[model samples]
Target: MSTPKPGKIAAQFMAHKREMRLSPAWKALRGNDKLVLERIEEEHMAHGGSTDSLPVTFTDFQEWGVRRAAIAESIARVEALGFVECVERGRPSRAEHRFPAKYRLTYAHGPKVRVTDDWRKVVDAEDAQRRIDEALAELQARTAALSGKLKKSAKQRAEDRALQARNAA
Candidate 1:
């Protein structure tokens, strides 16, 4: 077989990490955790790792295997990614181990979260929301167009009726 591409390998690695490695499950959850963290950093212009610094918490990150390690890793990774890190160490004896080190959203990496080239212009809450809104608007517009097309089919009945009348006449 031809040599596998580097990008393909990297993508596979990332997919596996998301699918298996990270937990609490929401540790890598898509938007809210992802987007909210981004917003907090933009607002602060600095890494806000503590509750005092950053206002948001890792809302729904659940506990899983090697719970303590997972929380710490999540914090470090989130921090490394330039988002605020919040750690609330849950009681050791508590059934849930991932309780204490609660992660929070902040400027994850000190004062800089890298915005991808295309995303630079729209790196704030408003921008992110706007992007979503624009997409939804496009979806709505397309839906409306589709509805209009469907409505045209109703006219087919009228055309059929006229055709029959003409044929009879």
Candidate 2:
């Protein structure tokens, strides 16, 4: 898979902002939380379909102008909202270097929720009502025409029967 570009990642994030905004958890997120989320998303996107957890460091957030304390708080808040999951906590041992903490996005990672069929019905109810009205009008016209033909046929049959009776008499 091609690496996810920053431009592509930003575009995707912007597209889903509306749906994100609607979520209370997302709305409650602070600037630092947003920064952390964005950084994680960018890394995830760059990873390009890798099921493996993304490796990130506090320096990553620092580079983005987020403070260490803010990163910790943001991570907590993000994890609380079920948006970011910390896969492995990197151990910074004095003797050896360890991998940065790994993370991933939860189900809320995709583009914003769209108008599903049920919502579409509610939003376009008036248009649907108009179409139903047109169909009813067509049906009414056809019914009127059919009823007129039936009446004519019945009247003709009565006349024929009466004539036959008169002739017999």
Candidate 3:
């Protein structure tokens, strides 16, 4: 094959060094987690390497083929693996204040920034998996607790309404 043009290659390709691809942390990433990280990296590249605060939304990841249900967990896994750092989490509370989550790729540094290779801390695939599992377990417990509280509050409201109706009668 003929030699490819540098400009075309640079414009079209996002490079992952062989070492990074071979790293335990990278190896331990599930498919969805890799997709999440790739979407974030694409956003960073689209911004011309300004890795400071790359905003990537759930919709963006979904568009890139990450399942809607898996997006949150996948993002969390990638962060836990140290491939990305969440600078600001998105809030969906109000339309006027709504914003996408911002992130920084740990291996890619912006201007005047040094690379923070957090993934290197993971000694092996098992270590990476352990960290992910622990994070997920904690998240699940917190979610369950919150769900219980919400159910209790809803039940209380219903009981209060019934009492109010009886008094009115």
Candidate 4:
């Protein structure tokens, strides 16, 4: 038996059948979500077909034509649908401390790993939509709460500065 070429292997892995294309989780993916998935797959392929710990940064997605604002949500949506899982959550801290998130495509198997088709759990379109909607809503709520807290802290700091100035005078 002969080993398949890299291109042939990648094409086979990336290709989906018509039935899979029509599946609820697959069909529910938006353009950005699909782009995010593709970008991750590209990264995986670049790393010699390693499925886990594939680092796909926001900038990478942006270069692939995904909007900056949509990148996080797209990642979340794909994750919610079980197409990928974040193994390490990246933090946007100081440049020295910054790290891109690492991901694993659930459907792709590595030498020692087995495929986990988590998307198969999604029963229908409505179920897939509901899962994505719920995850996004929760994310929005957390973002809003954090914004509120930040605003409160800023206001407190301003008041402290004003009081200090009055006392100095």
lDDT of candidates 1 onward, in order? 0.41, 0.63, 0.83, 0.83
Ranked by TM-score, the better of candidates 1 and 3 is: 3
Least well predicted 10-residue stretch by lDDT in candidate 2: 113-122
lDDT of 2 by residue, 8-67 (tens): 652333234465455555655678888997788677666653544778888888897788
Lowest-scoring 10 consecutive residues by lDDT in candidate 1?
11-20
What count of clashes does model 3 give? 0
Over 1-169, each residue of candidate 4 has an lDDT whose tens digit, in order, gives 6787865652425545465577799989999999998998788767766557888778899999999999889988998898888899876767577688999888765574446778888899889999999889977897799889999999999999999999999
TM-score of each: 0.30, 0.52, 0.79, 0.79
Q: List where candidate 3 sits over 4 angstroms from the true fold.
A: 1-13, 112-114, 152-169
- Tell me the number of clashing residue pairs for each predicted model: 16, 0, 0, 0
Q: How close is candidate 2 to the true structure, as a TM-score?
A: 0.52
Better of 2 and 4 by TM-score: 4
Q: How far is candidate 3 from the true structure (C-alpha RMSD, Å)?
A: 4.0
Residue 130 Cα positional deviation in candidate 4, in Å, after optimal superposition: 0.8
Candidate 1, residue 34: Cα displacement in angstroms equals 10
What shift in Å separates residue 21 of candidate 1 from its native position after superposition?
A: 15
Q: Quote model 4's TM-score.
A: 0.79
Candidate 3 — what's its lDDT? 0.83
